[model samples]
Target: MIRVLFYSAVSFLLTSLSCSAEQKRALEYTVSFEHRAAHYAEIQMVVPTPATGTIELMMPTWTPGSYLIREYARHVDHLHATSDGKAPLSIQKTSKNRWLVECPIGKDVRITYQLYCHEMSVRTNWVDRDMAVLNGAATFLTVAGAESTPHRIHFDVPEDWSRSMTSLVAVEGRDHTYVAENLDELIDSPVLCGNPVVQDFNAGGVPHVLATIGDSSLWDTAKAAADVQQIVARQQAFWGVVPYSRFKFLNVISETGGGLEHDNSTLVMTSRWNYRNKEKYEDWLSLVSHEFFHTWNVRRLRPVELTQYDYETENNTRSLWVAEGLTSYYEDLMLVRAGLIDQSAYLKRLSKSIEKLQTNPGRNVQSLSESSFDSWIKFYRPDENSSNSRVSYYVKGCVVGFLLDARIRELTNDARSLDDAMRLLYQRHSGPKGYSNSDFAAILSEVAGTDMNAWLAQHVETTDELDYQPALNWLGLRFAASKSEGTVAETKAATAPTNEAAREVKPAETDETPNDKREEPRAWIGIQTSDGSASVIITGVTHDSPAHEAGLNVDDEILAFNRYRVNSRTWRDQLTQLGIGETIDVLIARRGEIRTIEVKPVTEPTEKWNLKPVAEPSDEVKARLAKWLASQ
Candidate 1:
């Protein structure tokens, strides 16, 4: 009697399952590639249940990850609606990116449109005879009020294409069919279809796929996979959890080079032959690490201002340094932690950033927070005076990250570091509504168990010069300026041993020249040039320099120097052979007006900086140094 009851219950459950499956309406999208020859994609969206009063569809003006509004709807044309039985429905253009449809109630509606996709970018769509990359924001439309509705997508690939890849989950027992839970997820997932080489691996017990679109025969994809696996493992350990079950790394080999991060995947464009060179290969690895780290940073631990993205306009925030700059700091740091790069190489990269920040006059004009806020206008749109007026949040932010890590380590006595603070942010602020900059400062202080208000106010909120002393002193090192002309490392510090101290007060090798063998001092023109033109154009004249004092403005064409025809390629060499404090005749064409002037060149400024170790250090200093530079 119990067996008979169980059989009847199973039969009823099976019947109810079948009925539910039959009742669920299918929301399907079909993308056709037959018309790709004209750079057009035919997209048809089928809605099983039509709305009663009015139905509105919208194409996003821009995509996430990339902040600019590209107006994706401009590429759409020939859009019309029809009933499931092929009866035409009336449609009207409501806005720049919106379309309205008027149809009878309780009828199925199918909207068909054509997209002209020739722009080749990570955020846009590109279709050719060889391959097709479809970004959801540029290809799909959403029902105005039904953004959370589930979507089903099908691709009609070309005959030559062998496979398709995306991060979205695939439908059961279906070929090239995927499902997205909502409009945001659909836009976040990009589809690539072509005869590409794909390699799959498991990192931290999670599946990861690397897909290559262009020629990759020269690339050692196995080595890349191993390195990426290491990166994934280290990052997993850092955050203590992996958010996504499966991830994808989509690499498109082309002449252009860039990378964009997504929720569960990343798209990178690079040269086909980059793997052949060691430095280029390491750079590629750094790029991979940078984008992968974003999975936790900007994608989740974003600023409150960027918690909810606005697709139609600019979303401004004062915390991009935390987003992009801190990411920049970790790009190379992760490389070292993964054993892909050494400590020396990491320091070299850090010193390079220091040189950039120290040399660019813009650092004195723009604060780190202000630079982050004005990125949409000032950072992206730059002029010749940009170096003199604005600083990059990326460069300065990396420096700040370095300083903060060292300071935190000093305060916690190697028991904690910035890594701990980052983990706290990830655990507490990973939400749709993110924490603000003030909240971040507070969290940082709380994690480090110290007051960071003064540091944050001085370095981040204002344009005050950064003091590298705190960081360098902790490492038993000092910052010094270089006087050597060729090498970036001219290792003489302020307290460095002098000739007398080294030679036991033997002899002075000072600026004294033998009477018979006097050498001419080197001269500086202080004018940067642009080459490959009929006449050399002065690109810039340094402030308070001889060229600036002589009124040799930018864009002034140099006709001759010392009565000799001046070539931009040889001008620097000529100046090198001249003596300091010597006046030279210069013929220039200022705004098409020819004139001659005599200007005296002076000695060049010694501003190139270097990082050098201290001669003698305290035991506490040595211990701190070891703790800071210890193996990650």
Candidate 2:
């Protein structure tokens, strides 16, 4: 009897779910850009009502991928509701992001509102005379309890607008309509409308589109599409599977910056002139690679805390070090693997990341986990003391990923690495089920063939200094020697050949003089300054440095150094003339008052984070390095 009752209950649950899905399919949204020049998007949503005589409509407070409570409802204006028969209904504000509607039971309600879309960002909405970029979270309002229903959206493109683009599945036989499986899918897809230069390509047997939105006369669309194709193929090879049937790269060349990842598409903003410069173009490619990589890391195989998004509030997690940091580590590496850059370029980029992490004092104050957890409060909202109190999960995570990769290779006798661990983690916990920290550590242990929990704890959960020796040794790499006379051990370690067959690999010479050969160290005040109209303005004072100790503050305009007038161009040169330990009077304007502060110059810290190939490397080590960097 009990078994029969259980079967009956299952049958009833399935039937109810089917009915709910059917009811949700009734929800339809229509977006029109009637006032395109004024940057207002008219939104009309027809929602199916529940058995209750009242229903609530809500707008998300923030978008995913970009972490911040943006309060999207603030953009909504002049909202009204009406019954399906066109009869007016009473709507009242229930909360900041919700609206209560009194409607007839079992009747569909039509909600109409105007959204101000002047914010030009990847996660928000922007509409002008020429173009429109709409993010779902910042544009749509859905019925409260019917979020799981299929949401169909129709775009009423302006008559002059050429086209509209989105990753949402198109409705058959409809002019400009698309359908989403649920609210999550709706929010994950962004729409771009205008006459964009569309370049289509295929990767891993899947269709992909690159829609460039701004001026294209100077942009190389063909070359960019081809490079992006290479990135897609390489990343697909790394993951060994193509998760999305079709993908889109929404490249808005609107003189902006940033990229937000979606499941089947990515919205990236950049300047129209980025393609002209080699370094700037490479940076754009890296941004593309970073966001595309998220198709697997954060968009799918995300931290359990982020597995289910709470759009109204912060969804905190301690594993962004893996989601964002590991992704950062692989972004540039994947670029090299895709043949977009050479090993030297890759090494230079990696060296910069190492330099950034090593030079940051906050690395000693904040752990990787803490950095990830406090990102909502600290990372996005930065202040003057941020550098002294916090570290970027992205930078530190990238360094740790490098070290972890090398350690895994060492533990497994060069047979396995972090790549293997990531693949395994994805295989086990890809869909709705997300992995925890212990699960990730266990995967790493399995791949490395050893216990890695303690190491992981030390690097992720505590503020312990990271040991870079193991990775350097495994890859036959070392940091470049500085002039401070303390890099002898490093130089010897890099130059000492172990056997007759070992080849000596000297550091590449550049135009700059060798640090060790310089006559004297440069003087530093340790205060970053910006150019003001009349004087140099101090932007930031390094913690515990000479400038900080001298009671110098940020925003102070420096009128003179050592009683001599100085401008932005001559301030650094004048400061450099001062000898170390020499006390100098700095004249500054503090909120319109003149003051003089005595500051002693100090020897600038040596640059010890530049990475280079070891001076001596065995054939085995060279082979390992080759394998690590070789194209897949």
Candidate 3:
């Protein structure tokens, strides 16, 4: 009778299951970070439901948009776990990236682990004496079985720290931490910290904050604030609307190549600017403006394929050049509108980037869609042949932006431009349901009153380089093109090779195009790594460098270079002994595999060392250029 009762209960439970093949379960977590201990934090999680299947806990190998897997899991330490607040739950490492947590099959499990985390990385969990820098997608731990279930993270921050910046949904009581309903949202958010000097101001009657760093006082705060204020104001004035409730400017105090945009905030890495270099300062202001404009463009006003971002794969869209490139054009235009940059400087910047794209080889290998789609690998982790294999969507896209804008202005008789297209995009696809590629072209046609098929098919789809002549002529501008090597005589030339058997000799000389192939590489590549201490480790062997010919191998930590003791203070002294072709005996430890390789240095450098921008301004171009300048 008992067996009959059990069978009936099992049948009823099975019949009651939801029609939807239940997506896994979620693990709830509370993490407490103490600033006193630089690299330690406590994490507690309760895994509920779907206990029968194996769960895979993962940390993202890389961040979105910024390609390159850093293997973030290597940094985690002391990860002890449990079930239901009790010690000793069975967990095993299944792979470098996965952990299998064994529980009573289908049983609910609770866990807690203390992570010893320490790294100054922007995309991983970092806790220092200063503040915590958390990128949840790469740092948070999920149950192996609950990777699909909705999860939560509650943060506990040190009381003395006043401000934190992120767009994540914050728990009501979590002091310094935030939450993500699912893993996707967690991947998109990066939390900023360290008593961010918060300043609130109004733009277009909407509130925004310039979350300055402690070193922010170095700049003329009033000018920086006014720059952003007017850019926002001009955008609102043009679009006739403001999309965000508030905006945050995370002014990080680091030397940077550029800024990345977020929904309500922009994480900008930059150093102190000079009050004297007003022109350069204005250029930077335009950079900040570009990122701010992205809030509407790529962030909300997105392509259909990009609407549902899959953190696991590339979010490719054919329209990024339009989205990002158009934004770049507007960023400068906004500066012109705000009277920050003169029209001439603005047009010159545009002309320069356009010329660069047309001259690059990679433009032939990749289309705009392919560029956007493969950005996860190509755009960020550039390589020796990257210039030959890819084109920056930023450079080429902006050219298309200029041509489209000019065409729109000329076609509409100065009444409308890309700005109208953007406003329409904001109206139609601003809140969810991003625009499709076809929809964008339709809008362009509506504004211009002409079919943009040939232009789109040629420049956007096919690898045909953009022809900016007709567009430039529309504004009575004369396009310019020049090639002269003598213009940059002051810049160092790429050294010629003394022998034929060495590395490929850099080009002897090339045409005077800004995108000319003769520029020097950006770094010195001889196989050596530095310990935080005085030790110099031979980490790699260049193919045909003096080190490779001299028989140097990997893991051979250096002892001395040319008899100079390579202590911390004497490191630079050792590097001086090996200037291009000057050979010296290197003493090293190849993991206690100590050896020496003597290499001869050549008189000519093995590489090019610097790059300069070439100018090609011409005559008929001068008139349209004058009008553009006058507009600014």
Candidate 4:
């Protein structure tokens, strides 16, 4: 028996050494969704290798495009390794998301693991009886130092679930086999498996697919498809070329809001009723356009820091304002260009962004570059102080993009604009090498025929207030604010007025009617709440507001309002019940002490900003607007 054992071990060693000499490397990933109802997937990977030492594999901590680190390795379990079915291979856990596999040189190894994927988001993976959304980063393992090696994926799904959708091209003559040039490409392509409404269209002579993974009864698929196709064609024309051979949009209508852009596709999550409402549906289309534009802006013309990604750490850069913000700026502009929305509607959206910036006190505290750099910590994790301390690069960046475009047009007599800058940047750095922050300034100057040093200093690098008038002035537009005031009816719990008496209270003898105001005045106390179950806690207090003036502190839990019990749901109603200028007692628990504070409700002024064309314009201004709007 001992002689037989020795002979067997010798034979296995010989086979491994022979395999190592060939130095052949191949990755075959088999994913099974038959047990998806249990919120897990069984994955098997067969790797043929030539390495003499240990093979290290790593699971990415975060997916690209999503700034937050999700620690996807935590969801992986039931890990086992084998070598040519000869004997169990030695595997060691090296780090939180890394494993070292002991392999005799040239030996073939197989790794089997189960992944729990209950989370539902564009960047994460999810599975259920009905459908599965698989993000490649969260589902695949990367063989350290072998990222450039070609890999193939095979899906083993239930017989009933026949449909599958992904941006990856399938291997010819291989059933369910898809090839990725490298691990990065594999990680960029997400797969959606299950029954879905799939629609195909051609834009700019490139094939496009729209796969909706939920109930599609409410949406007019044909109309939506045509609109989407127009957006694609318009963007293709704007960029002057289509980067990818084919593009796909994987949409999940299980919830509202968000999308993550990829190399050749984008995963969009939206409300089930998004199509039923005109505004919601327009927002959806804007989302689609936003992600598609990213195919050029970030996916190709990326920032220097993102040119080569390190999945284990954050790829922070001060240029996301251009990556994400510029994409946002074009979302609505592309819609207008595609005739999905009129110029008037586009102005409304732009005006809305201006209003948001003006209202956010954080705009004065955070620079666009700082906002982009700290996105990993600040942008994704918002607290009450977020509004007061940090501005959104997205909101302010779009405003800057608008101003930049107008500045370029103004300088060149509409001969060159921001589009010229984009084309130049794309031409120069459309690959593995990304542009730096200074590079953009240089490009903008070259396109505008002027020095942009001061422009970058004042806007991108500092928190100086932006003056929209200059840009608006050049575009034959003016920013105007009109004040229309209204009085709020007072209601007292002890001596509450009847409905008739409430009507009798005159609205402070004003010429302004209810119709004149764009938005009705609301009683402002300026206290924001955190997510709570039993009682609402004050998470923030706006500066100089009644809540701040009355000594309301963040983390103070509100127990009652004016002697009445109140929680998060009832607090807003309690405040709205009181009339403007009315004082009420607020019972709050602060530092283990209960106290009553006198708080008065006041009518707050809500500013309405609009960028309207000048009532009468000079011929040059009119010509600028016409030409600007007419460009791709």
Candidate 5:
């Protein structure tokens, strides 16, 4: 056992450190998906060793590519450790994080645990009747202090499931055989359990697979493969090489949201299975391209600070704007080259980003890097004040990427482009190389033959607003800004419309509902309860809300509204039937403590997230449009 753990560590450090960005580490493994009734499953890991120590096992608090610390370890359960056969050593969670064990310092150890995979979101793990979906980082464990050691993961995958496909470091043969160079390499690999609906093809001398879950009935493979190929080819051409011999696209078909990247593949949560709409289908392909671009832009080519990741702490960098935004630039570019989208669509996409950037107030407060760094604190846990205080690197970063592309073209008289800049960086730092704010400027200056310091200082670092007019004029376009709102029709009881006429009246027919306007206060009850079966379950109570003012706490089930029996889900509708300042007695079920309380409703919480149609399509918009139209 000691020898096994020690070998795993040595393999990881030796292999991962020696490889360049252009090279890929091998991964092999077998995974078993046990359908634990209707929700979640059980998984076990048998890892080979290189050189071990007192290995402390841990699950990443968050995924690297996602840019947020999701506290993944919180859900892992019943973890136990074993050493070969030496009476299975005991492993206790030493910190809030790692599992500490005093064993044969350098050897092989097998660990097992039960995971509660109940969530259906793409970001969460779910082991249900159909299959089990696990992100490599979420399921794979690491050697406490030996993160740099090389490793190989062997899975006791069930034989019922045919095979799995991923760009993760692995080779074909036994279900439980693959290599990992280091902790980062291990974390970078994503594994799929159960049947992965795969479509195999190639681009730039490497194979590509669109491995999706559920069904693949609606996929337009003819148009898809070409666009996908172009996506990889473009990035390959830019970097002058394809880092991995093979790549995988892990598509977790759902009904909403996006994806995150990894070393050789990407994990995407989308609406691909029930995909019926043509618009949605093409859009999904674009998303696939977005993540694929990151294989180089972010996963490999990164800001110097990102070369080595600190899974336990914040690894901040300003270049994410470029790493991510430039990747955004190519999402469309690949669509164009592949003919998946055309010129009109490409410009439409860029124009939309322009409009988004123009209207956001956060543009005036936060810089791109600030948004990128604060992502851990702000991006994932978005709430009411998010918009007024923070900006998105995605929005502004795309614009800067566009502007940089144009600048590169203009400076070299159309002879070179930002593509050259990206390629140069990839080749130079393909192996653990990084850049600083200064390093970034030097690179751009070298490629453009001019100073890009001022441009970046204002746009990338400081809060100085964008000079849209000039940037658009340079690309031959226009800009506009307008207030957008949210949907009001669906909320029959969310709040009492201050406008008496609006009491019974419905929301306007416009596409968007009014934004978080500081309009007249309607009424806020300050209780988060879901109405169900003519009753309400009080999930939480804010500090001074009418509910809290009167007295309320979480886990209290509401039995009635004003003595009228009403369940949790329907309480809101019942409230909208009444008017503002209306005082009511609430009935609830709390640990057998049946109680009634007086409360008044006020205005709802302030506006936070906003999404609207594009209004400003700038000069650089054409590139984006071409990509979108081509995707179609």
Candidate 6:
């Protein structure tokens, strides 16, 4: 009798523990797309009520990676709540994204709402007759205090929709149901409900799915998928680890642009016709490489500031330069290393980034750290003067990354590169407890065998002009000569030869006539104009330019230049005909009032920043370059 009683008690304890586990996952959601044609998704949630007699629900204000407050609650309509007995419960809006509901104690509560999801971006939700792309942050509302608890979602896909795809773990014996370990996993996983062209491949012994929607038979799906596998293999080799069990690349060929990274998957949108063009297709591949690199950079090894995300409000960080900029730097490099693009193509792409940074006047105003911190306000919300005041962390950070990589190579005599530093950082801090700015510098210092804190601070914290001499010399590369008389400061710095071998190499010339050979300098009005139906509207005026000095404001209609009638098509040509240092009458219409402003055109600044290898590189330099660009 004693043994029998002991066995019965142990069984009872095990049953109680199982019941407790089930209760933690008692929240169930059913999403139906009955009105998808109208771009509506109906959501039904069932929650197990606590003994407190009240519960709060919250819809996330913004999704991760986008860094903008989208106010997802604005799309919710016809929200209602009820008790287990079907009795109506009192529901009140406590905040813009929160709802308070009163229900019977120790009972279950049912809540239903309709969401209108028509936004076409990767961060938001979109549903039409043909398909539905749903982001969890914009689609589901969670019980406020129960975010750590498991949540199950069931998709009642439409009859015409073939299947649903996501990175979430599927529930066994259920047709379209999936479970999330926690709210974070649910939000990180995006779902696609449609008949997308699915392709499967394995890299690093891990399964990957490439699902392309809206193909329309225009995309080279097979080749794209094969190339994507190569990218995956290259990136995995770089990291030396495959972090996830499986991965998915949710490609949407919706004639759109942009991509958002997730933990185990990514959503990338592009036009179907991009595959036919070599440059555009390579650009799409670059996009893929960028988002994939984030799996190791931001998604896992992140800054301390972004270690824990606050979904309700802005999560500020001064390390987006490292997160996004480093990713930007590696995106194209990865493509070359994967053998998808040749070395020439890679250099061309890198040169464009350098050119963009050199031309943007904001590089002198905002430091990379400031750009990362103020991305919520200044980066996303740009005005006419943004170009003069705000720099892109992605651009400057990428340039800085290139210089940093070269600096490391120089310090260690090519014995160690930035790749070692990244791997070391990942080994030390790729977890919930992220590293600080100083921590990142320490890693670089360790790899380079020298302290880099001061160097890092000067580049990240101050808006100081970057010195490109080290990178140019170490890489045995030079900037192509400018067509205009006054080349930018960086061009002058790059022109200095590294060795006697470099002296034998003739500087690469642009397609335009040389500055000394040209008959006249190119005249610049310094205004970017848009072609309106009836007039040429000034959209932007460069800072300290002739247009800005003459008070040429944005939105001013330029009816003519030098009193000669000119539209947007003819304005530039006519402006070019005018002599530099000569003031000409530019007629304008401000708010329908006819006016004329005198403006002096100056010689256009040289903006060429093309990078090319030295024509006569020494054997040593050639070997270094090979090591830098070779596949891992």
Highest TM-score among the candidates is held by which one?
Answer: 6
Residue-level error in angstroms, candidate 1, position 426: 0.9
Q: What would the per-residue lDDT of candidate 5 be over residues 190-218, giving only the tens digit for each residue?
A: 66666767778887656678777755557
Which TM-score value belongs to model 3? 0.68
Off by over 4 Å in 1: 1-27, 85-91, 479-557, 578-605, 610-626, 629-632
Q: How would the candidate models be sorted by lDDT, starting from the highest?
A: 2, 6, 4, 1, 5, 3
Q: In model 1, which residue pairs have backbone atoms overlapping below 3 Å?
A: none
For each candidate, the alpha-carbon lDDT, in order, equals 0.76, 0.84, 0.61, 0.80, 0.62, 0.84
Instruction: Report clashes for each candidate as comma-separated counts.
Output: 0, 1, 14, 3, 92, 0
RMSD of each: 8.4, 7.1, 12.0, 11.0, 9.8, 7.3
Worst 10 residues of 6 by lDDT: 501-510
| Candidate 5, number of clashes | 92
* lDDT score of residue 47 within candidate 6: 88
Clashing pairs in 2: 505-615
Angstrom error at residue 564, model 6: 1.2
Per-residue alpha-carbon lDDT of candidate 4 for residues 1-632, written as tens digits (9 for 90 to 100): 00111212334543543354245444779999867889999999888754576889899998889898889999998888888756688889999999999887777888889999998899888999888899988999868887877677898778878777887767555666676667888899999988888889987666789988877788777788889999998888888867776789998977756899998899998877889898889999999999999998999999999999999999899999999988888999999988899888888888878766766667767999999999999998998677778888899999899888988888887889998899899989888888998888899988888899898889899987776766877887765444442222221111111222121111111113322363555566776677647678877776556787898999999998789999876676577677678999989999999999999987654443456676678898788887777686
lDDT of 6 by residue, 18-97 (tens): 46547574578999988998999999999876668899999999988887888999999999998984899999999999
Q: Name the runs in model 4 displaced over 4 angstroms.
A: 1-24, 480-522, 530-539, 559-584, 590-593, 600-602, 617-620
Residue range 1-632, candidate 1, lDDT tens digits: 00111212334544543454356544679998987878889999987677585788888987877766778999998988998749998888888989888877887889999999898878888888878888999999778766757778998888788888998777656778887766787888888888878889987667899888877888988788889888888787777777776789988876567788888898877788898988788888888998899988988788889887766678999999989888888888888887898866777777778767765667768999999989888887876567667889989998899888888887887678888888888778986869888888988899789989898889898977677766777777765543343322444233322221111110111113221132443456566666567568877665556786788888888888788887855665576566567898889998879999888876544443356566677898778766665433
